[model samples]
Target: MKILKTIAFVGLFVAGTASFAQNADEIARKVHDLPDGKTSSFTAVITLIDKSGKTRAREIASYAMEEGTTDKSVLVFKTPKDVAGVSYLSFEYPDKADGTAVDSDSWLYLPAMKKVRRVSGSNKDDDFQGTDFTYDDLGKRSLAKDSVKVLGEESVNGVACWILEYMAKDAKAKVSKRVYWIGKDNYVTYKGEFYDRKNNLQKELVCEDISQISGYWTTKKMTMTNVQTKHKTVYEIKDVVYDKDVDPKFFTVSALERELVK
Candidate 1:
């Protein structure tokens, strides 16, 4: 009877754990599906701080649109004569195809080069314009790419949160694992920790100053810190509008070059 009782208890524990993991995946999906409008545009001020505490700032105009299950975005640098006219574009797909997971298609336009170039898939881990954020970090990440488990519940800045751990499905992923503290009320990720290939903590991300814009919750300020290098980057949204009709051509490479000429 004692052995039977012990086995029953173990079975119940396993069932509970499985249920919790399912709930965590559901929560992550909700977070990923947060309702941004069909079209959105914003201006952002990005500040990059190096290990020595020296800071450089850039201004950018960003536009995004939802096309079916894919999201496309374009960022155009507006200020600083040197980097002005530089732009990046990305198109994120929702699922794997042809028996392989699909990464976003990304492109960069340099004023000096006078041409637009495609950013290769292997370079997704590279820093974006010397900032802490990588090219992959800028695009929408599909939950299907990772296996999620609920770590537990926690609080971030006094707000209740669900702690989740995500392990990459691919061995060659830049980030082997990531932990997220997602707000219970808003379904927004308030804090995240990224682990490198060796499972070493490499970076931390914090999102704050959330506000409702056009009936959608939006993060107004975000900071990414490189743990090993002590380098940091802060992005602050200045002006934002939603559901505004942005020119479809603006997302094309030809349009990127034309904008550079202006």
Candidate 2:
């Protein structure tokens, strides 16, 4: 749920000690367990760009916190009067003791309808609010759902990276395989590619403006592009603060309907 409409190598043991540390399974666990923050607040600007070069932008104020083993987050729209006051709240749970995947619970509040709509698990592959990103792309998916392998290493923009590939265990999954270029030193995800069920490249994601924010490596800008449709979505993070005091009520469905996050 901490995701914002946002691998292991198995190569032979190289000569250096650092290269031997490139175990695929270990990198998968490390990336999945990256430390973000107990509480975080940030403003996200979502921009939709069509093939004709038209662009529409939406601003969302997002807050996230950890409650016990559950992670809670809320996105409240701020600008563009047509979408102002719209909010989305989600609760992400950890995997069960048996390693079964537990889908996140999400709800969306529509101001025009004055109603709350629940985002079902079946809609994970659907586009998130017409953007290029899908609901599954915006949530914390369990690592156990995929088989990760090391594809080797490469340099992305002069940054050394480990190329990791992931194949979804679910045969019917919309995304069958994914590849990522993750930073070796900081463990930050720098680039990624998503392949559809037919194993064709569907979307590509690039993370830029990487820097340390409150001791945490943060990607301030992300762009996701659809290869087939030529539609793209850009997310820009601003005014980020970690461990900020937040209202418990902000993560509630009732609060979303009542415009508490406004």
lDDT of each prediction vs. the true structure? Answer: 0.88, 0.87
The regions of model 2 sitting more than 4 angstroms off are 1-22
TM-score per prediction, in order, is 0.92, 0.89
**In model 1, what lDDT does residue 24 have?**
85
lDDT string, candidate 1, 147-193, tens digits: 99999999998989999999988899888998999999989889999
Residue-pair clashes per prediction, in order, are: 0, 4
lDDT score at residue 107, model 1, on the 0-100 scale: 90
Candidate 1 wrongly placed segments (more than 4 Å): 1-8, 96-100, 260-262
- Root-mean-square deviation of every model: 2.1, 8.6
Residue 241 shift from truth in candidate 2, angstroms: 0.2
What overall lDDT, based on C-alpha atoms, would model 1 receive against the true structure?
A: 0.88
Pairs of residues at least 3 apart in sequence or in different chains that clash in candidate 2: 8-24, 9-24, 9-150, 10-150
